[model samples]
Target: MTDAPDRPNGGSSRGLWILIYCLLVPAVVVPLLVPLYDKAGPTLFGFPFYYWFQFALIIGAAILTLSAYVVSTKADARERAARLERRDRR
Candidate 1:
């Protein structure tokens, strides 16, 4: 098929990134704007509930973003390898 090679590799791990972003955006934003309903702990660096929540969210987002990047790259590489293998076998 002449157009077969032109077709895009349909396996995109971007969904994971999107999911992470979706979770993270709200995690970071919600925490800052709205305080936690129930929690009693001494504030760190004199930061209030909202500030602390935002700080933790940012840290969590960073970790998730890193994980997503690694996983997506690995998946893309694997998919590329499989495609190449199929092409070679043909």
Candidate 2:
């Protein structure tokens, strides 16, 4: 089998990663599925489902992104640091 190539960023690409796929869910899937929650039930503090759901989606997106970043940071700390070092040198 052919060996993996050394990447400038220090990690070789193994193609699509699941963690990266998760990063797209809140940004892509939620926005595309707006019809699913386009309702007026499930009120929150007098706010209708539409308004509250949007706010919840915003918070959910933020949390998902932060979680992904934290998980990825732990997983690729060395590779990311190396990439940053290379970038700053150029």
Candidate 3:
């Protein structure tokens, strides 16, 4: 057999990676789409929509990035454990 460790539920792990990408993509993409928040009306406490929305985006991005980080760490840990188990079997 190959040296590569067997991943139980490999498809699930692939899905998890896809989920991680989905979590991260909005954090990077939404803010770059400037026109989405380029507005002056609908102020929050005298802050324009453009300004407040940017702040909100910063918070949203932080949460999304944090979520991605947590998911990736767990996935990495699982893969590492599987690799160790496979090596031990040899």
Candidate 4:
């Protein structure tokens, strides 16, 4: 067994990959939830459903970006704390 705290599971970080999958929800769900034609109703920029769909896409993208950032930051913090604890033990 290695002393490295980073490899608590036989050097396999499957949990990290699982975290990534969980973070992908907003990327997949937000666009589906946005009812562009029903919400925008008619047209806004002479683009029929185009304009509202684009807006929804942008909003969804922003949410997904934020979600990804939060997930990544949490993972980084967890790793940092773990490393700090390991250092303190040395």
Candidate 5:
């Protein structure tokens, strides 16, 4: 069987995975800290600060999730391509 080529740095993608996790952490963690937004002052369009903040968090989480999805999709594609190339070389 033919040997596959070696990639630089052992083909590690740990950094990209870490970045993806970082991008998703706030989306999961922020909303759980209720004390940060548990207030009634600073109303927005007749809504309390707490209500508006939660709405904003929903939008923020969606954007962050979408970004994470995009990054992971690209990473997965690259990994798949590398695997396929290795298989083809065999």
Candidate 6:
């Protein structure tokens, strides 16, 4: 009753969501991890563990988010190419 290529797009669009989840790892990790760093055992440039940990989290979050963007962009580009190829074949 239905063609193979006409199947629903399920796994075909999973990359963006996977990328989003990857970035969310840091957001979730920081809140839970920060409590453990609420002491001054380590110091960076005179800042206590609490302060330096926040800075490191900021940088790490940024990197994770940037990587997510790149991954999603690549996924989108691949989708576009697939569409174009199907159109050409038709």
Most accurate candidate by lDDT: 5
The lDDT for every candidate, in the order shown, is: 0.62, 0.71, 0.84, 0.65, 0.85, 0.74
Model 4: per-residue Cα lDDT over 1-90, one tens digit each = 987446432333346656777767756775666553445456766766756776767887777677777777766666666667678889
| Per-residue alpha-carbon lDDT of candidate 1 for residues 1-90, written as tens digits (9 for 90 to 100) | 464433235545456456656655654565465445235456777876555766687787777667766766766775676678679878
Candidate 1 displacement at residue 85 in angstroms: 0.7
- Enumerate residue pairs that collide in model 3: none
How many clashes show up per model? Answer: 0, 0, 0, 0, 0, 0
Every model's TM-score: 0.56, 0.61, 0.84, 0.52, 0.84, 0.68
Candidate 5 per-residue C-alpha lDDT over 6-76 given as tens digits, one digit per residue, 9 for 90 to 100 = 65334745566888999999999999999999999999999999999999999999999999889888777
Relative to the unseen true structure, what is the C-alpha lDDT of residue 65 in candidate 2, on a scale of 0 to 100?
82
RMSD of each: 5.9, 5.4, 2.9, 6.4, 3.8, 4.0
lDDT (Cα, tens digit) per residue for candidate 6, span 6-69 = 3134435566767778777876777586568889968988998888887887788788878878
Runs off by more than 4 Å, candidate 1: 1-42
RMSD of 3: 2.9
Candidate 5: count the clashes. 0
User: How big is the positional error of residue 39 in model 2, measured in Å on the Cα after superposition?
Assistant: 1.2
User: Candidate 1: lDDT of 6?
Assistant: 36
Q: Model 2 misses residue 25 by how many Å?
A: 1.7
> What is the Å distance of residue 54 in model 4 from its true position?
1.2
Per residue, candidate 2 scores C-alpha lDDT tens digits across 11-89 of 5323224675667576668867979889999898999999988888888888888777776665576567656766888
